[model samples]
Target: MEYFVHFLLAILLTALSYFVGSRIISDGVAIWQALIIGLSVVSLGALTEALGAPIWFIVLVPFPVGMLLLFLFLHEPLYTWFFTYLITLALYSVFHVIMSYFFSFHSLIPAWRLS
Candidate 1:
């Protein structure tokens, strides 16, 4: 059940990322392209986690995926994609760190603790 939930969550997160990325890019980006990029990012994250890297490292996976997609589809310059990728990575890393910290903290609280 737990694994199923995680799988579902991964799917949802990937979809959400794709939606947001596509919307932001907005100039002829196809849904399938977005989905592919999103899935790649999520797969990288999963692989990193499986390899026993810290959660923070998993958060960095999206940037390269996004950059690759942008360079491939948007005709964007590689340097532009690289810069945006770094910014996206930093933003995601902060978000992941904050969410993980709060989640772990809440889990430690007696009311939220699972045995």
Candidate 2:
């Protein structure tokens, strides 16, 4: 059940990110392009994480790089992609944390809890 909820959250976040990017950048970006950007962002983060970079680097570096790629190659502006990516990451993190707490909490003791 929790996994399903998280999956849905991911889908929602991707859609929201695409919408925001399209709105801020231009209506020209196709749905496929937006989805590619979102997926690429996730892939970059995962690869970086697997390479042993700190988790913070995943959020900070990949977003800008992804936005730049989208802008330079895809013709979208940095403002649009950047803002949309940030919003998506923020929402995903928040929801993931909340769900982690709800589903993984082992005890009422705050300090003893683990995600």
Candidate 3:
């Protein structure tokens, strides 16, 4: 049950980050495309985690995949891609902190505990 809750929270945060990031960046990446990129990042992260990767590796895995997916799907230019990725990361971190501190949510990344 706790796992399910964390899973749902992770999904929600991932999607929300991309949605908000795209809107903030105004990179013209559609909402649906943003959603796909977000979900893909989460899915890839989860897969690496499930494969028994190290904590650091699991944490690091999603970034490149996300940037690649962003470029491949949205064709965003270099600066936009970097800025969008930065925004996504920043938003996710902020949301994660809020959820963890205020709502007692689990870490979005494995082997991490904010509580």
Cα lDDT listed for each candidate = 0.52, 0.54, 0.76
Q: Name the TM-score of candidate 1.
A: 0.54
| Model 3 worst lDDT run, 10 consecutive residues | 104-113
Per-prediction TM-score: 0.54, 0.52, 0.83
lDDT of 1 at 93: 44
Better of 1 and 3 by lDDT: 3
Worst-scoring 10-residue span by lDDT in model 1: 105-114
Task: Estimate, for each residue in 27-67, the C-alpha lDDT of model 2 and write its tens digit.
Answer: 54566666666566655655675688765665565667556
| Stretches of model 1 off by over 4 angstroms after superposition | 77-115
- TM-score, model 3 to reference: 0.83
Instruction: Give stretches of model 2 more than 4 Å off.
Output: 1-12, 73-115
lDDT of 3 by residue, 1-115 (tens): 9866776668778877877876787655677777787778878888888899998998898888777876676566788877877888899888878887777775575555677
Prediction 1 global C-alpha lDDT? 0.52
lDDT of 1 by residue, 1-115 (tens): 9655655455444444444544453443466765666567666766776788765566665556666775686556566555545544454444345434655322111122222
In candidate 3, stretches whose alpha carbon ends up further than 4 angstroms from where it belongs are: none
